[model samples]
Target: MDEHKSLADNMDEFRKLIQDLKSMSITMVDEDQAVILLNSLPKSYANFIDTLKYSRQTLKLEEIKSAINAKNIENKASGKSDADGLMVRGRSDKRQWKRNGNGLGLRTRD
Candidate 1:
């Protein structure tokens, strides 16, 4: 898995790899597939992987895939994914009300 690529891209690659293996008559258990996917994640996903890996319940490939997809959505929404070129953060501060040429205070609030 490439850390430089987005989670979606990595997941796609993983799916392709699994497809190729299936074509070659390679078979793996669900647990093994989940483990492989978790292991293939980037270092940024270490915490997520550990959380899933150490869970008490048996691992399911579909669940792992769902979690990855959810995480990808979250990262993209927060501008934290590798695929995002820019990150926007909200800032809140107080500033003195200044009058402009129009004789009105130039202040905007949310």
Candidate 2:
């Protein structure tokens, strides 16, 4: 094949293949189901998806799941939160953290 196809073109071809699969008697697809599936991904899974896409490395579903799970555990252990920057706890009245690494504002719970 002399013609080179871009990532977007290959993705379109893949989409067409999936759509064609929907026409088969045994296969079906629902946009609502797809949206729900995508929305249900954990933060780490979403991160993993981006990493996988960018790295262009082939990996199994199990491998991706394990990686995401490990990352989630690590984040939980570090007192870091899935929330946006500057995680605030029940005490907003508490003084702001210092720039120094003393307490580090890293308040992980056992």
Candidate 3:
């Protein structure tokens, strides 16, 4: 019975030591170290999401252009030509469409 009690106490101490070591290991891993580890990952995997986003955006742009061209062709085929009238007006018209910089100000230059 005494030997069993000693073994149980040793096991408890060993478990506590393991827990302390695990906590210390976590504490040693700082934010910068974590960021460095993330950055060190393979470039292909890191850029995977960005690559898919860019490809989807490009595909959408191409689709929009094709739609616009198809509409223009349909109008032309129907003998309804107003190409010159569709051209954008002068700079004054564009001035009103100026982007409101959301209070960031006109010049973001440092």
Query: Highest lDDT: which candidate?
Result: 1
Please list the residue runs of candidate 3 whose C-alpha ends up more than 4 Å from where it truly belongs after superposition: 1-59, 83-110
Per-residue alpha-carbon lDDT of candidate 1 for residues 17-91, written as tens digits (9 for 90 to 100): 999999999998988999999999887788888998897479999999999888887887887864444458776
Question: How well does candidate 3 match the true structure in TM-score terms?
Answer: 0.22
Model 1 ranges with Cα > 4 A deviation = 82-110
Candidate 2 residues lying further than 4 Å off, grouped into runs, are 1-48, 84-110
Residues forming the 10-long window of minimal summed lDDT in candidate 1: 82-91
TM-score of each: 0.70, 0.34, 0.22
Clashes of each: 0, 0, 0
Cα error, residue 9 of model 1, in Å, equals: 1.5
The top-ranked prediction according to TM-score is: 1
* Per-residue accuracy of model 3 over 1-110 as CA lDDT, tens digit each: 12223323533554465469678884333333323322332332234324433555233423433443464466568775422233575644322233465844353222
The deviation in Å at residue 51 for candidate 2 is: 1.5
- lDDT agreement of model 1 with the native: 0.84
lDDT of 2 by residue, 67-106 (tens): 5457656767997444325446695454544444674564
Q: What is the C-alpha RMSD of each candidate to the true structure, in Å?
A: 9.6, 15.8, 28.3
Worst 10 residues of 3 by lDDT: 1-10
lDDT for position 86 in model 2? 45
